[model samples]
Target chain A: MHVTPGQPLMVCEHCDAVYRRRILARREVAHCTRCGAILERHQWLSLDKQFALIVAAGIVFIIANVEPIVQVSLGSSNATTTLWGAAIAMWNDQSQVVAVLAALTLFFFPLTQILTFGWLLAFARRGERAPGFRQAMVMVHYVRPWSMIEVFMLGTLVAVVKASSYFKVVPGAGIWSFGVLTLLITVFASHDPRQLWHKTVGSNE
Target chain B: MTGVVTARERGLVGCHVCGLVSRAKHVPPGAMCPRCHAPLHRRKTNSLTRTWALLIAAALLYLPANLLPIMRTVSLGNVDDNTILSGVIELWRNDSWDLAIIVFVASIVVPMMKFLVLGTLLVSVQRKSRWALKQRARFYRLVELVGYWSMLDVFVVALLSALVHFQVLSRVEPKPGVIYFGLVVVLTMLASMSFDPRLIWDRKETDD
Candidate 1:
């Protein structure tokens, strides 16, 4: 495959058919000719747009970590827990592996995503490439599937349903924050990874 | 000679990163994709070995996950410890049939089905049995999609443990079973990733 400076060679991963990459007009998408899988979309958000989303996600993530997700009051006494608190409570109860996984999926990976993307996008916005940007992009791809905030939130909903049968489960600031954060993360992740890699790395390959 | 042509017949290998078909003959060994820098692999390295390892690990974890208590609730000097199956039965007894079904399918049915399906696919591939190739591929896709939902039970335990505390009067906490169960879910997902779906197509050229 002779990849000229502008015309890059593309292969369909689904069907293994090679084709010359073509430019697309705004709102146009390139699909694999053999398998009909989406190859690339033209109208991707700019780096600054992605940066704005990252900032919003970062704020919500902080709130979700700090505030209580739910508070339960039975008689005179009450109990509340933030996301980390839940993981720690599991740790104290001898379920150490689950606690560690909870922390990694819910807290660690998402924060790493935000920080890595924030740095890369900031560099791209300034028309400059940061050192290790390629590595960061790879990290983002690997981390995306492992970060299970949406799944965790759904689990929280199921927990709430289970708890609602026995006692009053008051929704707290953390739950709302987590909801918003999950949405933002989805929005952030939905963009085509190929396009982002192209913009950040810039036709260098 | 006018029969079905494979990608290898045309010297084409798909780029896993950019989804582009490139001529395999022209690319030297260990060359990166011209469009994207991802390293090219004809098939995932050590695909079968890795898949088997992960599958066995998941199977081992499955034992403790189902046998032990997932969560325990202590209320007003009374105690109840619920394993995955017992928890489903408790939900059914309480007349929350919908929740019971959901938990049953997500927790019980999904894992078992995944194990059976993946094991079958592995066997068929190893034996070079070209039966229902397309359906088998679709089944693999289903296994991938349904992988995360199995975590529902674990999340429920975490949520309840965090919320339900009555300072000496009542308490709820996750048990050791959940940790093992969580491991089972993750290990299976990793096993799926280690599998190469393209291997399913490779059989077509060799058989039938």
Candidate 2:
């Protein structure tokens, strides 16, 4: 509970009750006394494991973008599109705003989040803080809610079922990769950035 | 025993991002929190008006979202255009009861409820009605959380348009209505974000 110059003191976001901040043991979580909200979550996974997961996620993300996500055949004509193509198609068809929104939520923001996490984690692993470590962490938090890939997947499932009545729809390699990427992103995003920041600052106290 | 004092009673406000507490008077517009370097606001400025504007825009878009075709499917030279309601009905007719319910709730029920709940919250807050204060706060939380679920319909349309393409046999394309529908979802989500839940408690002490 010692208050140091650089150490952050916390208040409950929901209730505004001030409290001293402390690093918790693995699997430990600090809860707000007034509102019962999670203030911090410290999990047991070391930095390396999280970094490996991020690398795996980045690879999967690449595959998702490169491969065709779905293939459909109706009588004599068939069409296939990658994730990027889906948004671009909309853009070409005059729905410019929706297209841009789709691109940002589906691709750009998520990519930014992944890249930021990769940079921060890489620096943290070497016990060196990145120049923009704080800003990157903040960006991750802001960008997280906008990444709607999993929701898009759910929509895809519904769309596939609806389309099945008219013609044949086959899932593609991109679909598989997209699914895997979604899970990986969720796992990595769920880990608290505060704990990661603490790890990067090191045990030099 | 001392009386229970609320945070607002102490003139304190907490930063949502970093949980930093400071005197509300000290946090002017564009001021950053000392601890987290995040922008500090006593209350989100113009929260009510901004939320109202966004919600009204969503309401106007809701009509087109439901009335016009969301997707057009062409199969063997036969064209079928389905609006949100028609699409739900088509799912029902096809015996996909589960999916039909899900689409109906996500696309139709949720947005309508969001508008109603948000409207009621605005009215209550404006009038400073003390009735159901806790419930109103909880309701706002629910709206904030589930606001994005309405995007389910937009995603479905986008994915279908991308996937269901066959040169002459069949093709699925997004209709103009889907654009409006997507706009509606985004607007409502923004409205939810613009609302300051802390205001629910603020007026209580002031009005009394």
Report the TM-score for the A-chain of model 2: 0.88
The alpha-carbon deviation from the true structure for residue A36 of candidate 1, after best TM-score superposition, in angstroms, is: 6.3
Q: Label model 1 with its docking quality class.
A: acceptable
User: Which stretches of candidate 1 lie above 4 Å from their native place?
Assistant: A1-7, A19-46, A126-128, A200-204, B1-39, B92-98, B204-208
Highest lDDT scorer: 1
lDDT of 2 by residue, B96-197 (tens): 999999989988888988999999988887887867766776777778767777888787777777676566666778898999999999999989888876
DockQ of each: 0.40, 0.39
> Model 1: what is its DockQ?
0.40
- The local distance difference test score of model 2 is 0.76
